[model samples]
Target chain A: MAKKLLTTLTLMASMTAGAAFAGGHIEGAIKARQGQMQLYAHYLGILGGMARGNADYDAAAAQAAADNLLAVASLNAGSLWPQGSDMDSAEGTRAKAAIWENFPDVGAKSMALTSAAANMATAAGTDLDALRAAMGDLGGTCGACHKAYRGR
Target chain B: MAKKLLTTLTLMASMTAGAAFAGGHIEGAIKARQGQMQLYAHYLGILGGMARGNADYDAAAAQAAADNLLAVASLNAGSLWPQGSDMDSAEGTRAKAAIWENFPDVGAKSMALTSAAANMATAAGTDLDALRAAMGDLGGTCGACHKAYRGR
Candidate 1:
């Protein structure tokens, strides 16, 4: 859990620095994707805090965050991942070339996130225990994709 | 409309540079709010394109973007606007201290965005004309808030 928090913090820090290193050509795309990721992290950060007892659980807040997560997950974001916008090609992104190479595999991974977010959207405001359970699935999906597609 | 697009392009550019101007203390709060604004822009950009015939109007795409806009607007974002996190106190943020001073006024302005977004969510997928009509309301709400609380 500590490691996960650390990773989240690290990701946020890098995201902040990313704007400074924007690639000249596809800078818009990079910023758009990074912004999406930041929103995901923002909502997840809220739920994670409640699940871990770092913050008191407010059902309305939890539900809103979960819904935001699902909405973002459902966005038609294909335009934000144009070819040649990977980390190797872009200055500030951590998207790996493997993502472009993976094609439908990356698409499937994104679907998993959507599915997990949908479940959490249902579970988040119900109760603390339910939120904790759902967070496991959501967090696992996030970690799985980062392991496969994200670069350091 | 050209002027609006230009303003949006300028906003995106500023948001991209925002991360580079971290306010040191409230950077996390600043980034979170900026991310929310970017998400709003992203969805609005999609709907605006379709409305203006800049992009072919797909019902599914329009609905998804509108839903995302509503979800983002509905976020419980009170925490992202801590006292002393406005433009006067934080770098990279256009949020004016007037927002903090306005109390429920700022809250009401935000609620206006939510209502407009909800209407857009219902209209966006119905037809181009419906989408265009709703966009006027949504865009007006955005402009009103920016004029009142956002700084250049």
Candidate 2:
């Protein structure tokens, strides 16, 4: 019984330590969120090229990129942004303090991107003109969020 | 006819330039793929903590992490592996030349990860025991690929 109790105590101690580590290590969260943004950029770049006629519009590739964009955009990424990990506190990140200050607004703005991405995904595989039309809405969401929440 | 032919020539030149840029400017590919790896690590960290009993097993969080892992693992990421972006050629990547040399093998290895992640996604939300069982397979796939294709 004593041994079992000791083991339980150790596990509890380790769990507490883990929680502390998770709370403090915002660097990992910062890097992970930035990586997620890179994915957004990559998929967006593909669709943007096709929209601008800089690259030929392949239906399959367009669909794939748009689908990927929607998948990442739809993620519940709240875990990636803990308090005190904004531009003022963290290095190597452009996420502004306004993100935490204006939480619901930031969330709503992100939802706009998700909605735009859903529309883009539906239209991208259809045709170039359809993709072109959807691109405007999608791009606008990205720009709005960056302008409001990302530090230059 | 003459003006149309000139327009065609201009488009062709731009297309060729775009292809050349895609083939040569491998820095973006390196960064993008590395970012992808970062995502895999992040999602895996979430599940790993629960599997190791370092974090309490929340069914929802586990499911979300597993689903995200499967999503990224299933991406058609061939474009991210442009030939010249290996460890020896790229500055900020640990992808080894073996990856290029053994393309089919690398592809097969990646498929294993996808397969494992799919199973993990199914099992993770079920229970802690199920998540623990799935984690071993998922972690093994990661280790196998890193052992063969990732550089030190």
**What lDDT tens digits, residue by residue, belong to model 1 across residues A15-48?**
3344322344255657766777877887788788
lDDT of 1 by residue, B1-152 (tens): 23323433433343334432224325665777777787787678878878988767767657867876786676555545656677887678888988766755666667778889999999998999999999998999999999999898
Top DockQ: which candidate number? 2
> Which segments of model 2 are wrong by more than 4 Å?
A1-21, B1-25
Winning candidate number (lDDT): 2
Candidate 2 lDDT over residue span A1-152, tens digit each: 23323433443343334452365347776887887888888788878888988778878668867887887776556556656678898788898988776755665677788889999999999999999999999999999999999888
Chain A TM-scores, candidates in order: 0.82, 0.84
Error of 2 at B34 (Å): 1.3
**Residue range with the least summed lDDT across 10 consecutive positions in model 1 chain B:** B16-25
Score candidate 2 by DockQ.
Answer: 0.23
Interface RMSD of each: 9.0, 5.1
**TM agreement with the true structure for every prediction:** 0.70, 0.81
Query: What clash pairs does model 2 have?
Result: none
